[model samples]
Target: MADIEFPSVEWFQALADITKEDPTYRKFGRLNAVIVFKCGDKHISTNFDVLNIHEIREVGENARRDADFVIEMEPDVWRGMLDDIKKNGHASLDWTLNTLDLRFDEPIHRNELQDGFKADMFFRYNPSLQAFFDNAAKIPTKFVAPVA
Candidate 1:
């Protein structure tokens, strides 16, 4: 298996690729939203069109202004959650996106950029989004070294 770096477009693409081929990812129905994931200063955005992830790219900090919403957290927190997913084949109860969003420790902040209408997509497609991330377990990933 090839090792892909986390928080990179390549890594996110791997996830999208895997999910595209899985019938399970299709059951949630079509999703139409632009979700930006932020780790510290890095911003990666993915556009979900119909039933597939159409694009994944690294965007500038200004991406949030265009996204329906942004999910922000420290890289360490992301790594921790990824590690947990890898170990369990999927996120455990505590590491699930909803669970992490609820926890005080390194909580995943959902910053709504638009009105409640657009921001509601995150919840409307929560199962699909969670399944998208769960596909990460299918890829072997390497964490980029943290800068001092």
Candidate 2:
């Protein structure tokens, strides 16, 4: 199979498909959080409702406001993380979202509504989230640099 473009609908859907088949995701418990991925011009929103990851879609204009918490980063950063997962079959400790959040400046700057609880959900659900991304190792990915 050809490598899916990073940040494309096909790419996110591929990961979502993996989450559906993997039972490990079930062990994480129920989750109800809207996760936003901001890679340059692209704004992708994924709803982790109840037991499964539902509705992985793209949005226009407002991603952060629409989502519970938005993870904004350059496309290169996303590519690196995904590539690491593909190589290692999971993210190395350094590439995990929590570690990346700490390493980057203004990683998750909240706008207007300051919900610490929502932000904390990322950590609370880290294992499942990590496993979700970890499944990316099964899929081949193509890197596309974000538009400057």
Candidate 3:
């Protein structure tokens, strides 16, 4: 509701909070994974319970090792994407997660997926993953120079 800083737990919390009241977020299939958004050194995770975002918090760097997968991006890249979302009410074609993931040489990483099952969630729920970031457009976010 306020101007929350991007890449922080509060910002992701705001996004997760918005999805609770909006039916569009739940209309998609379940996003059953602990999705981590890593900006620079900040690691913020959103745990999805079926189609709902069950939790949002900042975790240590080891989050990548424990998470099903992590979406890692440079601070400038994140700023560009979020800025576009804010200006257009959603990410433009070029800024969408899939497009940018490829454009940046696959910023989405599958860490410690020993059984190979965990990695599938990223692709299986790719659309929902995209929607989740698109949902961030609904939050009031402010960007500043990254700390690390």
Cα lDDT for residue 133, candidate 3: 76
Among the numbered candidates, top TM-score falls to 1
lDDT string, candidate 3, 96-127, tens digits: 87788678655455655553688667777887
Better of 1 and 3 by lDDT: 1
lDDT of each: 0.82, 0.80, 0.77
The TM-score that candidate 2 achieves is 0.90
Worst 10 residues of 3 by lDDT: 106-115
The collision pairs in model 3 are: none
Using lDDT, give the best candidate's number: 1
| Cα TM-score per model | 0.91, 0.90, 0.89
- Candidate 1 Cα outliers beyond 4 Å, as residue runs: 105-109, 112-114, 146-148
Q: By TM-score, rank the candidates, best first.
A: 1, 2, 3
1 or 3: which has the higher TM-score? 1
By lDDT rank, best first, the candidates go 1, 2, 3
Tens digits of per-residue lDDT for model 1, 3-49: 99887889888899999887888987898888899876778899988
User: Which ten-residue region of model 1 has the weakest summed lDDT?
Assistant: 105-114
